[model samples]
Target: MPLWFDSHCHFDFAEFDQNRQSEWQFARRVGVSGLLIPGVTHARNLQLEALCQQYSWSFALGLHPYFLAEHEQMHFEWLDVALESSLACAVGECGLDRVLAVDDAHWQQQLACFSTHIQLAKRHKLPLILHIRGCHDEAAAMLRRARFEYGGVVHAFSGSEQQGKAWLDLGFCLGIGGAMSHPGAQKLRRTIAALPKTAWLLETDAPDMKPAFWRGPANSPAAIPLLAAMLAQLQGAELNELSAQLERNRQSVLPASYLIREEPSIN
Candidate 1:
């Protein structure tokens, strides 16, 4: 079977603490060769780094928008330091959220935080892993203003065709997850069908975005193949063919240095 990559997953989260070893094994057995673990806050950088280093997995370091209450300007300073010292692949799991930021001040804060991450990614010459929710146009405008060079993936994409094209024009790939598997997600499914195959990158966003079959349960990287299958069905392509194309898409957007390495033995 062709190897698969979970371009976004929170394997560092405590949900995997008790069974991480078996989880990794299950992922490997299911043809998941690699995973990208993106940090949501400055505080988790150490833990995220350690997990990636221990498993030879790739990672992205940035401050997520939802945790605004927990972050401070000093965190950006720490993010700058972390980027220089660590082997992170990109600069996010960061972006704006319309619902999350209720007021204008809060929305502005999200914009500022997102801009800082964009600048950091530009400075580091790394791709961004954006987490846009209900603010695709806003995020697209910011990206256009920044004129960012390094491309990235927009994780958990569920937007209109126009919105999808906007992000594509900015040189970003869309991360497809369990959302596409839902029958009720007809609009998103139509968007996926309308787009070219190169516009997508498969992800599980584990411990979240559970697939239709596994709804109500914590997700795992092992479910990536199922996600890929759903996407392939929607795109009218063979599983392996779509998998190969998605891998190429991932390589195109993410920094070359983010390539997966062999995992170290648990013992």
Candidate 2:
């Protein structure tokens, strides 16, 4: 089995509510040493903390823009408490999403929320795991202006090489997921091939962005090796070498103390 790290996932989501423990065990059997769970909203902070304790995986806590309707002012205060807590690893799942038809007022509010996450991350010296969609330019601008020290990956990245280059230059890793597994994803496959190993991170975005092969049901982190194999083939690199590179890239961003165990030997 290839040693791997799923840099992003939502194991706390209801999809695995019934058998979340079994899911983690399956991931372990498949050689996934560690997984990072990003908090999608305030309500999930406690749930995610419990998940980290239960599964022994790290987690990030923040407000997701998609749930802005439910995010009240009090949530920020709650966020402060969550960030101060030992269970929190990073701050995010926060960023712009133009596809959701957000009004200008709400959009600005999201930006404010995003900025708050950045500030809290800096204060606590933890990395951030971002969720950027249709608004890469705006997100990049905000990231550039902030000049944050601890950086993180841009989850479910589907962007141009130029955009990717900008993020890479800004100390961010580009997260590749099941999106590139599709035969129709030529552009994304090309980007995956072009990205330097150092600038790449692996993710599943499970139960949401299902890969090409697994269509009907929600995707799971266990599909990492399948996608990693696909990505390796696209880059014309051997599976072991590619997995090693990805593992190193993941560890560079993930907390050092995370996933301490006997990792599978890639070679």
Query: Cα RMSDs of all predictions?
Result: 2.0, 2.9
* Candidate topping lDDT: 1
Candidate 1, 248: how far from true, in Å? Answer: 0.8
In order, what lDDT does every prediction score? Answer: 0.87, 0.81
Instruction: List model 2 lDDT by residue over 40-132, tens digit each.
Output: 877887578776877678788888888878887788788887688667777887887887645778777878878888888788887788888
Backbone clash pairs for candidate 2 read: none
**What's the lDDT for residue 178 in model 2?**
88
Report the error of model 2 at residue 112, Å: 1.5
What's the residue-level lDDT of 3 in candidate 1? Answer: 76
Candidate number achieving the greatest TM-score relative to the actual structure: 1
User: What's the residue-level lDDT of 226 in candidate 2?
Assistant: 82
